[model samples]
Target: MVNLWTSSEHALSYLAIADAIPHRTEGEGVLLNQVPKTVRRILDLGTGNGRLLSLLKIDRPQAECIGLDFSPTMLAAAQEQFMGDDSVHVQVHDLDQPLPDLGQFDAVVSSFAIHHLAHERKRSLYAEIFACLAPGGVFCNLEHVASPTERLHQQFREAMGIGDRPDDPSNKLLDVETQLQWLRAIGFEDVDCYWKWLELALLIGRKPTV
Candidate 1:
C-alpha cells in the first residue's frame, strides 16, 4: 500500500530487513566514495531511517545534513536517530511535491527511494536536485531500477529473495539508461550509472561549476 510507510510497524519492519538486502552495502559504499569528504552541506531525499545520511556524516563530521521524508514513522525514526545532534536535521516533506527551499547543498543523495515516483516526477526531481546543489556539487542515487527483460526481472527478484511476491505498487521502476539521460539533460555533468547488479544500481552525476 502507498500509505503503508505511514505505519510505524511497517517502517520498522523495513529497517529490520534493510541490512539483509544483498549487495546494498557495495552500492552505498560507491555512493559514499563519490561524495566529497569536505562537503559542507548535504541533503538526503526520502531518507528512510536516516541510514544513508548517518553513513555520510561519518566521513564528513562537520557537514550540516538534512534528511527529508514524508513518512511519519520514518521521520520519527530519523529524528530519534539524530536527536541532540544539531548537525543532522530531519525534516518532514513529501518527495511527490517539489523540494522545499533548504538552501544549497554540496551533495544530494537518495537510496532506493526515488523509484517510487513516476517517470516524469523522477525527471522533475532530478532538475530540482540540480537546482538545489551548489556549483560543482554531486548527486548520487543508489536506486532500484527496472530490468530490461522479464527473465532478468525474475532473476533479480530471486536474488533479493522475493521470488513469488507480486511487484510493489509503489514501485515505478525506470531503466538505468533513461535516468542517466535525464540527469544529463537536466544539466548534470558526468552523469553515469557507476555501479549496478541486476535491478540495484548506483546512478551518479555532478552539477557543473558554471
Candidate 2:
C-alpha cells in the first residue's frame, strides 16, 4: 500500500520543522528567481500546506494557482492557509497516480516532496509534468536527493538532526545527475542542479518553446 501521509502528527511535524531545514530559503529563492514573472498560471505538486504556492502567490498575486497533495491533514492545513483567498486552489491528489486533467500551467513547482516516489514513477511523473506545461514553461523541484556514499548519507542525516536512525522508508532518493539527465532526455531545456547543500538540492528545467 502507498505510504500516504495521513497521520496528523506526522504532517504537523513536517510543518513544524519545515522552515528550519538548512539552506531551504536559499533554494526557494533560486526557484523563485527562475520562474518568469509573465507566468499567469501555476501548479504545485505535493503542496504540503501550500507553502511554495503561497510564496509564489505573494509575488504573482494575479496568477491562478493550483496546489495538489495526497494527505488529508495536509489538505486541511493548506485549505486553512488559503482560506478567503480566491487566487489559489487546493486539492488532494496522490502523486503515486497520474496527474489529473487540470489543464496547462505556465509553471509547475514542488518542494521536498517528489523524492517519496519510486524511481520509475519519478521519471514517469516528470514526463507527465512536461506534458502538462505550456511551451516555455518551467519546472522547479526543490528535492531531497541521495548522497554520493554511505558516509555522505550519514553526514546528511546529521545535517538534518537525524542520527543513529534509519532513513525514512518512505524516501526513494535519486541522485541529482540522474534526475537532471532524465529531465534533459524528456525534452526539458537548460536542465541543471541549480543549488545543493548536502542532500537538499534545487533541480530546475524548462520546457522548450520550440
Candidate 3:
C-alpha cells in the first residue's frame, strides 16, 4: 500500500493539527535534553517542516543540520522554514528505501515518523542509522509505537481523541522492546526507550566510540 504521507493533502492535514498533540512538547523537550550541545552535524530523517530540527538548533546553533523528507509538501514547508539559513540543509529522502549517501553525523533524529514502514524495514533502518553516525554519535527517535495489548492500544487511541475511528492503516507499529533489541543487535550501545507516554515513545541509542 502507498504511504499516505506522500499525498500533499494528507501531509498538509497533519501539519494543520500538529501542534495540538498532547504532551508532544514534553517529549520533544526530553529528546532535546539528551542530545549533547557539542554535536557538529545532525541528520533529521522524515523531517516534517523542520520542526524538531528547529528546536535542536536553539541549543546547537553552530551545528549544521540536514532535514530530509520525501513528501513535496513537507520538503517545501521545511525549505521555506529553513530558507536563507545555510546551517540547515533541506533535502529529499524516502524512508521506505535505503538511505542515500548523506555522510556521517554527530546525531540523527526522527519525530513521529518511521512507523509507516514494514516491520523488517524498521530494523534495517536502525542498522543504516547506526552506520551513518560517527563514533559516540546519538540516535534519537521520537516514535509512535505499538502498545502491549489491543485493549491498551484502543485506550491509547481514545486518549489521543481518536475514539471509535478507523485507525490509520499507514501505521505499522512495533513494540518498544523489539526495537530496542534491534538497536542492540545492530551494535549500538546504551539502547533504551528513554521516555514514553502510552503509544508515543522516544527510543535512543549511541554508537560506540571504540
Candidate 4:
C-alpha cells in the first residue's frame, strides 16, 4: 500500500483542508487538557506543519519539543513554523519504522497521524512510545479511528464533506477499543479513549511510575 503522505501533492492537499475537518478543535482541546503544564519535554509524531506542537508550546512554553514527519513538504512547513523558536526541533522520520533515539519525553503527541500505518506497526509503535516515555509520562493521540460499521464510516466521511469519494488508501484505522487494549497491554496505565466525535477520537495513557 502506497503511503500518499510521502507525495508532496497528497500532503499539500490534506493540509489545505486540515483545519476544516469539523469538530477537530474540540478533540484538540481535550488532548491539550491531558498534557499537564509541568511537562519538561515532548515528542510529536507525524507532526504535520507542527500544528499540535505549536499549540502545546503555548500551554507549556518551557518544555522543549521535537516533531517528526516523513513528508518533505510537512517537514519543511514544520521547520519554517518553528524556525525562530529555540526550543523546537523538526526531523524527518517515517512512522512505519521504529522511532529514533530522540531521548525520553514527559509527553508524546500525534494528530491525525499513525492511522496510516499497518495495524501491527501501530501496535509496535505504541510499544516504542511506551519505551520512549519517562515514568508517569503521557501519550496523547488525536486520531482517525475505524467505525463500528460501514454505514457509520460512510456517515463520517459524509460529515467531513467527502461524500462518496474514494477513501484515502493511506488510512489503516484501528478501532478505538482495540487501540485502548493495546495501550493497556503495552503497560500504559489509565489508558482510555478520552474524547471522541464519530471517527475522530483521542487515545491517552500514562506510563506508570512504579
lDDT of each: 0.92, 0.91, 0.93, 0.94
Runs in model 1 deviating more than 4 A are 1-3
Clashing pairs in 4: none
**Total clashing pairs for each candidate:** 0, 0, 0, 0
Question: Ranking by lDDT, best first?
Answer: 4, 3, 1, 2
- In model 1, the Cα lDDT at residue 58 comes to 93
Error of 3 at 1 (Å): 3.0
Superposed model 3: Cα runs more than 4 Å off: none
The TM-score obtained by model 3 is 0.98
Candidate 4 to truth, TM: 0.98
- Note the residue pairs that clash in candidate 3: none
Cα lDDT tens digits for candidate 4, 11-37: 999999998999999999999999999
Tens digit of per-residue lDDT, candidate 1, span 87-116? 999988888899999999999999988998
User: RMSD per prediction, one decimal?
Assistant: 1.2, 1.1, 0.9, 0.7
Task: Give the Cα error of residue 83 in candidate 4, in Å.
Answer: 1.2
Model 2 residue pairs with clashes? none
Candidate 1 TM-score to native: 0.97
